[model samples]
Target: MYKLGYRNNNCIGCVKGGAGYWNKIRVDFPEVFKQRCKQSRAIGARLVRDSNGNRIFLDELSPDAGKYPDEPDFQCGFMCEIISKENNL
Candidate 1:
């Protein structure tokens, strides 16, 4: 992702992200964000959750939703190299 100007390796629009992350995607990669929103609706699945425990579509996140919590960095080779054989089972 850093190669494409994105600082993290998270998916284009990771489902685990919070409002702050979604909002950032809206500003930085509007097209990709839009695609995820549309696809999510078509499949009846959403990546965001609102304060009321309701699903908040990617397109509906508020501008100042919240701040992204700091996290440690990890690397993945796209191979399950980081996982253990026991965990895979």
Candidate 2:
């Protein structure tokens, strides 16, 4: 199961959080974030503020929603690598 948490104004459980995390993911893997955004936009999803004041994609709250790691392989690779690099893994 995917564990969820919060960090600052970010939802730790969602890839839309963490500038360093998302930036690295985008910089190192633009294609992945792009594709993921395409899919997200297709579903009319947006990065919304949760009750905790953290930003997270609305779809992420759904039980059937996709996890960050469940994104494209390149995106997953970047997330895992960056998380490990930042010692957040």
Candidate 3:
């Protein structure tokens, strides 16, 4: 995603994203959302866990429902930092 212009490594249609975020993704990056849904089904998993304890697949999410998940407002550091730390680099 960083290579695609996103600042962070968050997955496409991140499960953590709330309704507003997903809605925006649905509007702005429909193809990504669709692909994520397809991949999720292939893996037999969904990204979203609803309050009702139901696994709400991305395909089943209501475009108008869901709240944007809170995220840090700043970005710096590359994903390599995490990889290096794990490898004791």
Candidate 4:
């Protein structure tokens, strides 16, 4: 994934990923992308929110929705926050 310009080797269709990342997955790994959409629908788990903060399912995301990063742009999430707190950051 680093070779592909991803900062982390998270699973394809990782829930932490943004629409741009998912769209990249949709192209590079069609089956995995399809599976994620199907699974999200079945489980009612939206992996991302819009600029308006509305939860959005993968299937509902547009191919043109988000910006595709030319370089990895990782943002720290809750897990990172927890780890930082544990480390007294």
Local distance difference test values of all predictions, in order: 0.67, 0.46, 0.65, 0.79
Best by the lDDT measure: 4
Give candidate 4's whole-model lDDT.
Answer: 0.79
In candidate 3, stretches whose alpha carbon ends up further than 4 angstroms from where it belongs are: 1-11, 69-89
Q: Write the per-residue lDDT of candidate 3 for residues 1-89, one digit (tens) a residue.
A: 55444445654566556555666678768898888789878888777656575877778887667654453333335774685578786
Q: Top TM-score: which candidate number?
A: 4
- The local lDDT score (0 to 100) that residue 68 gets in candidate 4 is 62
TM-score for model 2? Answer: 0.34
Q: Under the 3 Å rule for N, CA and C atoms, how many clashes does model 1 have? A: 0
User: Residues 1-89, candidate 4, lDDT per residue (tens digit)?
Assistant: 77876767655567778878888888888899999999999999998667687899998888876666753466667886786689786
Residue 53, model 4: lDDT of 70
lDDT of 2: 0.46
Better of 2 and 4 by TM-score: 4
* Poorest stretch of ten by lDDT in candidate 4: 67-76
Error of 1 at 34 (Å): 0.6
Candidate 1, 1-89: lDDT as tens digits: 56554556755676656676677777788898889889888887877767676887776777777555442333444343434343662
